[model samples]
Target chain A: ETAVFQTPNYHVTQVGNEVSFNCKQTLGHDTMYWYKQDSKKLLKIMFSYNNKQLIVNETVPRRFSPQSSDKAHLNLRIKSVEPEDSAVYLCASSRTGTEVFFGKGTRLTVV
Target chain B: GQQVQQSPASLVLQEGENAELQCNFSSTATQLQWFYQSPGGSLVSLLSNPSGTKHTGRLTSTTVTKERRSSLHISSSQTTDSGTYLCAIAASGSWQLIFGSGTQLTVMP
Candidate 1:
C-alpha cells in the first residue's frame, strides 16, 4: 500500500532538455522531501517542503527546482539535464518530527 | 551537520539465523528510522524508533538517544529478507533525515 505516489516510473531524456517528475501523497503529512539516489546507491537530500513552504534546500545544482500546489503535491523540474542527473528521484512525505514514508521512486536516465 | 554511520557494511546469513545491524550518529537525534531497499530499487520503511525499543513482525529496532546509537535486529532471516538496510536520524528541531550508506544483507537457503 503506497500512500506516497510518483509518476512515470521510468523516464529517459536527452542532455540540455528539461524534465519534470511529479509526486503526491495521500497520507496528509505536512512535510515532503525529494531525495536523489545515485548509481552508487548513495541517497542525498535535495529539497524539503513543509506545509507548501520550501525549506532545507541543499547545495544541489541550479538545474533542480521543486514546485508545489497545495500540500499534497510536490514536483521537481530540472533544466538542461546532465548525465549526473541520471539517477533515481525519490519522493517522500512525513508529519513533522515523525516517521517518513517513501514512494517507489522515478528512475531518470539522461542520454 | 549530523552524520549517521552503519556498521558491518555487508553481512551474509543462513535461513533462520538472526542478524543485527548497528547505527551510530554524530549529533543529538529526535527521530530515528530504518528502511529496506530492494534490489529492484523500491524502498520500504521498516520501523521508526526515536529511542528505547520497538518491534514489528520479525524486526526489532533499538535506539539509545544519549549514546547516539541504534541497532536493528532481524530475527529468523529468510532469503526474501535479503536486501540493503538503511538507518537514518533526524536531529532535534530539524526535519531532515541524515542517512547512513546502508548495510547489505544476503540470506542463503
Candidate 2:
C-alpha cells in the first residue's frame, strides 16, 4: 500500500480560480509537510504541520493556506491562483525527526 | 537565499563510473537525509546519516554535523542510478525539513 497519497496528480485551472490539493499518509507519522518544486527544479518547503502546531515556511504567499483535520491528513488550498503558482507540489510525512516518506506529487498549472 | 545548498547542479557519467554529490548547509543541523527522485517520480529515502558514515547497497552517505555538510557517493554507477539527488536538513527541536537544490545525475550506458 502507498504510505503517502496525494490526489489530483495533475490540475490545470484558470487565473483567479481556487484550487485545493489533498494529501493523506498512513505511515502513522506525527509530522507532515508541503513542498514546491519550480520549473528550475528548485525544491523549497511551503508548510509543515504536526500534532503540536503548524509552521509556515515564511516565504510562502498569503494566498496559500494549509488545513489539517488530523495527523493523517494535511491539505493545501490556494486562493486566487496566479501563473507563479504553477509547479509540482509534494507531500511528505515523518515520525518526528525520522526519515520522511513522500507522495508522488501533484503538478498544478495555473493558466 | 538557500539554506541547504548542493553542488554540481548536474552531472553525467558513463556506466560503471563512480559519482559523488555534495551538500552544504548554512545552519547547524543535527539531522540530515539524502533522497533520490527519479525522472517523473516521487522522492525516496536513500540514506539518513546525520553525523558519521553509513552505507547501504551501492550507496554511501557521510555527514559531519560539526561542519554542517554531507556527501553522497554512488559506486559503479548505472543508468538506473540516473536521477535527481536531494539533501534535506533539520535542526534539533525543529520538525521542518529544509531541502537543497537537487543535483541532477545522468548515467549513460
Candidate 3:
C-alpha cells in the first residue's frame, strides 16, 4: 500500500525516442519532486513542484521536463532520450519542510 | 553548491550487531531525513529530524543543526535490514533536497 504510485516500473526505449513516467501521490502533499538515481546509485534532484508550480529546476537538460496536472500528480518527460539518460527515476512527495515518501522508481534503459 | 557527505560508504554487520551511519551537510538544513532503499529499489522513510534526537523502535536519529551533522543508529540489526541508507537535506528556504551517496549496509545472519 504505497502512498506514492509510479507507472511502468521499467522501460526500454531507443536513443532517439521520447519517454514519460507518471507519478501520483495520495498523501495530499504540497510538494512533489523528481529524482534521478545514476548507475552508481547517486541520487540527484531533477525537479521540484510546489502546489503544481515548478519551484526548482536543478540545471537539468532542456529535453527534461516536468508535467503536473495538480498538486498530487507530477510526471516526468524526457525527450530524445540518450544512453546517458538510462537510470532509475524516483518520484517523491512531501509537505513543505517535512518527511518525503518515494515511489518504487521507474528504471529506464535507453539503448 | 550544497553538499551532503556520508561516511563509511559500506558496512557489513552480523545479526544482532549494531550499526551507526553519519551524515554531514554543507549548509544549514531546514529539514533532514533518513531514507532506506531495499534491494528491490523501493524507498522507505526512516526518520525526519531537523535538529534534535529522535527514536523509533530500533532506530535512533540525532541531528545537530549547529554542526550541520546527523547520525542514524540501528540496534539489534537483522538480515532484513540489509539495504542502503540515504541521508537527505533541504537547505533553509529551499524546497529541493540534496541527497548523500548513501551507506550500504549488509546484515548477515
TM-score each candidate: 0.98, 0.95, 0.97
TM accuracy, model 1: 0.98
Candidate 1 per-residue lDDT, tens place, B1-109, comes to 7788998999999999999999999999999999999897688999999999999999999998889999999999999999999998888888988889999999999
lDDT of each residue in B42-79, candidate 2, tens digit only? 88889988899999999999888888899999999999
lDDT of 2 at A48: 88
Residues A1-111, candidate 1: write the lDDT tens digits: 899999989999999999999999999999999999998898888999987668755578988999999789999999889998999999999998899999999999999
Model 3 residue A39 distance off true place after TM-score fit, in angstroms: 0.6
Clashing pairs in 3: none
| Tens-digit lDDT string for candidate 3 (A74-99) | 99999899999999999999998788
Off by over 4 Å in 2: none
- What is the C-alpha local distance difference test score of each model? 0.93, 0.91, 0.93
Candidate 2 chain A — worst ten consecutive residues by lDDT sum?
Answer: A50-59
Q: After the best TM-score superposition of candidate 1, give how far the Cα of residue A69 lies from its true spot, in angstroms.
A: 0.7
How many Å off is the CA of B70 in candidate 1?
0.2
For each prediction in turn, the share of the native Cα contacts (below 8 Å between chains A and B) that it retains comes to 0.71, 0.82, 0.94
Off by over 4 Å in 1: none
